[model samples]
Target: MDKFTTLTAVAAPLPMINVDTDMIIPKQFLKTVERTGLAKGLFFELRETPDGKPVPDFFMNQPQYKGAQILVAGDNFGCGSSREHAPWALLDYGIRCVISTSYADIFYNNCFQNGILPITLPKAEVDKLMDAAKRGHNARISVDLEKQEVTGPDGGVIKFEIDAHKKHCLLNGLDNIGLTLEKKSKIDSFESKQHGTQPWLYAQAGR
Candidate 1:
């Protein structure tokens, strides 16, 4: 996981709601446990045609949003089956944050774990940001995780709420594994002492 402090980048606007996991990465691309390379399959159906050619009409397909790091989308985004790959795909595609009026609980939680910030803002604020995103690469939005505020292209600011704990974890780039590693010294000491006292546990009689 990467530390998310402040991001100033182009935002892609996705106005459709109920964007499920399948639509995000599709079922065909779910076999890999590896988080990398899933970006190729991100928004598969929406980005490609029946012959597998990239569609020109898609927002992500447009040249301006080719490297967008932020996404401004409609409400109820990331609904349906709880595949964590959705966030993985977005992250792989360089999307560090997603802002919508609302999001599915499972997907929202998954974003935090996968180093993606899923922001829920009011519709009025979202509309304002969405319009800014439509201004192509020239319009960049800044998301300050520490300040919990999104600064729009035209100098407008929108405050957002995030779980205090989640903010702490993201600020430190601490995932579940990273959190565990924070206590590595203590764990190592415990195991060393435990093995010395209970040597039988480390021995494999069969081996």
Candidate 2:
């Protein structure tokens, strides 16, 4: 996972509500456990036609949003079954953050775990940003994690709240494994003591 201290990038507007996990990466793309290569499958159905042709109508398919790293979407974003792959796909596609009026609980939690900031703001503020996103490459907005503030291209600012623990983890680029590694010395000491007390087990294995 990467540290998310601050980000300023183009935000793609996805004004559709109830954008589910299936619509994100599709069920067929869930076969692989690897996180890489899933970006191509992100918004698979929306970006492609029934015959596998590019739709050219989806927000992501537009030239202006080609390299967008942030998404401003409508309410009920990321709804449906819990699928971690959806976040993986988004992250792989370079989306480090998503802003919406509302999000599914599971998806919201999943975003934090994957280092993707899913912000839930009031409808009015989201609509403001969504409007700014319509400006194409000029949709640059700065998200400062330390300040818990989002700054638009025009210098407008909005504040958001984050869980203390999750905020700490994201700031330090600490995932579950990274967090456990923080106690490596203590774990190593405990293992050393166990080896000393259970010398027979070690000797048997070594023999």
Candidate 3:
């Protein structure tokens, strides 16, 4: 996971509600566990035609939004199955942040684990951002995690709230494994003590 402090980049507008995980990466692309190439499969159905050609009208397929790092989407974003690959695909496609009125619980948490910031704002605020994102690459959005603010192209700012612990983890780039590693010394000491107390058990396990 990468540290997420402040990001200022182009935001792609996706105004559809109930955008599920399957719609994100699709079932056909779920064969691989590797996160690297999933970007090609991101929004697979919407981005490609029956012949596998890029759909010209799609927001992500458009030239201006091809490299967008932020997404301003409609309500119920990332709904349906709890697939971790959804966030992986988004991150791989360079989407560092997603701003929506609401999100599915599992997908929201998955974003944090994968270093993507999932922001929930009021519908009005999200609508404002979505409209700004419609301006294409010209309207860049700024997301500052430390300040919990999303600034629009015209300099308007909307404040948001996030869990303090999640904020800390993202700021320092700590995932679940990273959090566990923080207590490495304590775990090592406990294991050493246990080994001394149960030498016979360790020998049997080794066999």
Clash tally, candidates in order: 0, 0, 0
lDDT top scorer: 3
Query: What lDDT does model 1 reach?
Result: 0.91
On residues 148-178, what C-alpha lDDT tens digit does candidate 2 reach at each position? 9999878999999888899998898888888
Model 3, 21-129: lDDT tens digits are 9999899988998889899889999888989898888897789886899999999999999999999999999999999999999999999999999999999999999
TM-score of each: 0.93, 0.93, 0.96
Candidates in order have lDDT scores of 0.91, 0.92, 0.93
Error of 1 at 69 (Å): 0.1
> Best candidate per TM-score, number?
3
Residue 39, candidate 1: alpha-carbon lDDT: 94
Give one digit per residue, the lDDT tens place, for model 1 in 86-178: 999999999999999998899999998988888899999999888888889876999999999999998988899999999999999998899
By lDDT: ranked, best first: 3, 2, 1
The weakest ten consecutive residues by lDDT in model 1 span 198-207
List ranges where model 3 is wrong by over 4 Å: none
Off by over 4 Å in 2: 198-207
